[model samples]
Target: MNKRVLRIYFLISIVGLLAVYFFWPKYEKLPILETVSSFQLENVHGGTYSLNNEKIKLVTFFYTHCPDICPMTMMDLMKLQAQLQKEGIFGNKVELVAISLDPENDTPKVIKRYSEGFSADPLGWKWLRGSEGDTKEIANSLKMQYQKLEGDFFSHSTTMFLLDDENNIRALYDMAISDNPIDTTKILEDISILIEGY
Candidate 1:
């Protein structure tokens, strides 16, 4: 009887310690990251997209003419959308915004066609394009810098941003590129965290 009682005590202690370790106050105390407000962007097919408009939005900047990084970036976001749809909360609860840096080439027609190509049913997706100066200001505000390269090629980040309804940048991610690939499961997990109270 004493041995059984001691074993029970040990098991309870182990469980308690695990609970403490996993759900520590210190872990909970880590502050939420701040986000930026009020930005504007244009999508690959050409449409107006504004940030911080009272929704949980995922925004990314890319140019259609991009030979390498842009395609990989879009694939990552599309994959993310698929994962979120499986969860059944991404489209209605979150906004997916894509902005294009190559305004000259990425017109509204192009964006529409692009969306069709990207997904048969592109739910909660907004492709944006605007005046070059306006787009520049928005991109600069987000600390995303880009410049036109020679020919039709451009260099830009494959990273995406999460913005709150109030125009704050809540989270950022490097979507899959040929050189670097992030874990899709982990990316979905992080996005789920920002989706709270949205």
Candidate 2:
């Protein structure tokens, strides 16, 4: 090539390099909040459940008889389950767990029925229940709060947590903290980012 052509090509290469360096999209990873210990809970199927060091977990709390928010949260998660399966990350890289706050009423049978009402897949999603103290302990560790109301309803924090394979608390998405609720897309995006990290 001629000297003029070579010089133009060199300038173009430098410009391309600069563009890539300055303009390429970057994904900021979700922040790790704290390390989580594997706590045991009972799945609706009468099997033991824990956050094993193998999959990313989307953990939330709910009760079978919750008037509104709990059901809304699980419905949102059912949508999320579909999205995760469509993305081919449902079982391999991601799992969902909804722990019951009212274990006394949310027996395995009740929770199983609840899980079925939403078409929750047992392989990808699990509805869990533990003793009242254990459930409270897990909630407290995730910085969630709950109270039993006089009307047999529980007022609780609707905070969703993301945990890595090692059971570390990676990120929290509080559905109650926002005037505009956090949509499922954003939650899936965060999960995608976390999965990509692994």
Candidate 3:
């Protein structure tokens, strides 16, 4: 081919690639990981709360006595909560749930205190505890594993789940990373995608 023709073709190819890169869908619909069955647990404030809902939810399993991962996760979530609240979607479109793994000891009162310590507003953040059997049932369904250690301590999964409005698990986030526990930026994007029906 002539040099001029080759140069023109290369320029066209570069422009096309740039167009695709810039105009392609950045955030596609998040895949549904699993559909969680509805389960009711005692809310920290008072009445029972069910997982089946129309609002986007971020759910994590933790115990009040957790020395490291649980509290750290809550702190990370607190940051997210502030951002969501600032955006005015904290309770309306998105909500957070922290279910107690040590249900026996994490009573309503204890969970309430824990929630307050993190400044977890009940309107947007729910602290839930149920019977041992119920807790295991829901945790197993969500694939969250936990085992009691000693003296109110327990080893548990450090994963948090993001669920769509239809109760489908959309994404899982790691809370065990020492340097970067939760990717709140990605999470906020995912939540926005879900809210916007993308």
Best by TM-score: 3
Pick the lDDT winner. Answer: 3
lDDT per residue for candidate 3 within 134-183, as digits (tens), equals: 99999999989989996989988888999998999999999855666789
Candidate 2's C-alpha runs over 4 A off are 1-28, 176-182
**Could you give candidate 1's per-residue lDDT for residues 1-198 as a string of tens digits?**
699999999999999999998787543221345656576565444344556457677777877777667667677667777877778866577767777787888877876787666782445777788888877877787788788888877777666777655656666777667877656676566566655543
- Candidate 3 stretches greater than 4 Å from native: 1-28
Which of the predicted structures, 2 or 3, would earn the higher lDDT when compared with the native? 3
Model 2 scores a C-alpha lDDT of 0.83
How do the residues 1-198 of candidate 2 rate in per-residue lDDT, one tens digit apiece?
Answer: 999999999999999999998888655576667977678888887679877748999888888878777776777778888999899989778998888999888889888988998889999898888899998888888888999888668988878888888788878886533244457887887787777773
Alpha-carbon local distance difference test for all models: 0.70, 0.83, 0.90
Query: Once all C-alphas are superposed, what RMSD does model 3 give against the true structure?
Result: 4.3
Q: Which ten residues in a row have the lowest lDDT in candidate 3?
A: 174-183
lDDT of 2 at 192: 76
TM-score of each: 0.74, 0.81, 0.85
